[model samples]
Target: MAAREYGQYCGLTQALELVGERWALLIVRDLLVGPRRYGELAAGLPRIPTNILAARLKELQAAGIIRRAPRSRIVIYELTPYGHELEPVVLALGAWGFKAMGDPRDEQIITPDSMTMALRTAFRPEVAVTLPATAYGARFGPAELVVRVDGSTLDVTRGDGPVDVAFAAGPDIRRIISGELAPDRAIATGVVEVLRGRGELLDRFASTFHLAA
Candidate 1:
């Protein structure tokens, strides 16, 4: 075999060289949701060593996959527009992985911000119903989200108010919507509990927000 030139490969190989590590993808995944401070990133991915994460961030920045912005005096990491294009690819891979691995019994957990973002992006407006009469709160991780389906829009938040339905689950929204956990089973197992609203309302909301075949 002839000698290989490290820099002569195509751009894809070059890109992989920077982000093909085990934790690098997860780093990108976190950034896909939104910009995060170093401490937030570290907490989100508890398995990654701090030094390695710092190194990967540096490398990704060098590769033009991410950029650092000052949230104050502190720097927060955010994906470039180029990096945002990878969202669909990452989501598809996650869907495939979920199907292949089968659903786990363990309770999944996600942040309120992440849940709201997921709903906003994945929601199909055509499937939505105008339910001005109902309001609800969903809890994920430390954040409590209040979802109000009024007229044609869906409003979600992390505060308290009058809500018709509340989804208090520990699992990530991605896993829950992908059918990794049966919503009823999650409630039955005590992994999630609803503070208000009838079962029909939850079913209607789920029908509208869940990923379709």
Candidate 2:
């Protein structure tokens, strides 16, 4: 085989070389939530130019990180099982970014997607709480999510329903987990609300899983 022009490197370096560009990680982050059409991805990432987005998607697909699926005469981008595995890595990076750069209140705006990622990242397998089957709702930006917490994991779907716990946060989930806001006070000020279910369970859930120093 002929020598490669990009130079030879180990797996990690090669992986980074494919995705090290700015906005590339964010592209992966958007796909983490769910499959999206080209327009949807482009809409979500306003900072990314159309041609660049197209090229990056092509690169990722070529590298086997994402796959293209045809739906309704349009192509949608979805992460492969291998690509799905990167969710934790992306979440960890997000958490690290939050910690290294102190919270800026003015800049703290939680979105539904962010909330879902935060929930997954903050989840503690050790803290097992049996959630009621009751439905719950939370609103972030133009999106409303129905959250169902079962055992150690949580399931969140789009739309509103009668949720056991209805909570809203003005700050990013990382800041909330980092103790910037007293969880109790959040409830008091209506920043967080537990509409149903055992309120004590919510408190215990917070204590057991919140990301502490």
Q: Please state every model's RMSD to the true fold in angstroms.
A: 4.9, 3.9
TM-score per candidate, chains pooled:
0.71, 0.79
Which regions in candidate 1 have their CA more than 4 angstroms from the true location? 1-15, 105-122, 129-136, 141-143, 146-162, 172-191
- Whole-model lDDT values for every prediction: 0.68, 0.67
Question: Which tens-of-lDDT digit does each residue in 25-118 have in candidate 2?
Answer: 8788878888989988887776678888988888888878899999898889999998888888888887666567565466445555656666
Q: Which clashing pairs does model 1 show?
A: 108-170, 108-171, 109-170, 109-171, 135-163, 135-164
What overall lDDT, based on C-alpha atoms, would model 1 receive against the true structure? 0.68
Please name the candidate that would achieve the greatest TM-score relative to the true structure: 2
Residue pairs with backbone overlap in model 2: 135-162, 135-163, 136-163
The number of the candidate with the highest lDDT is: 1
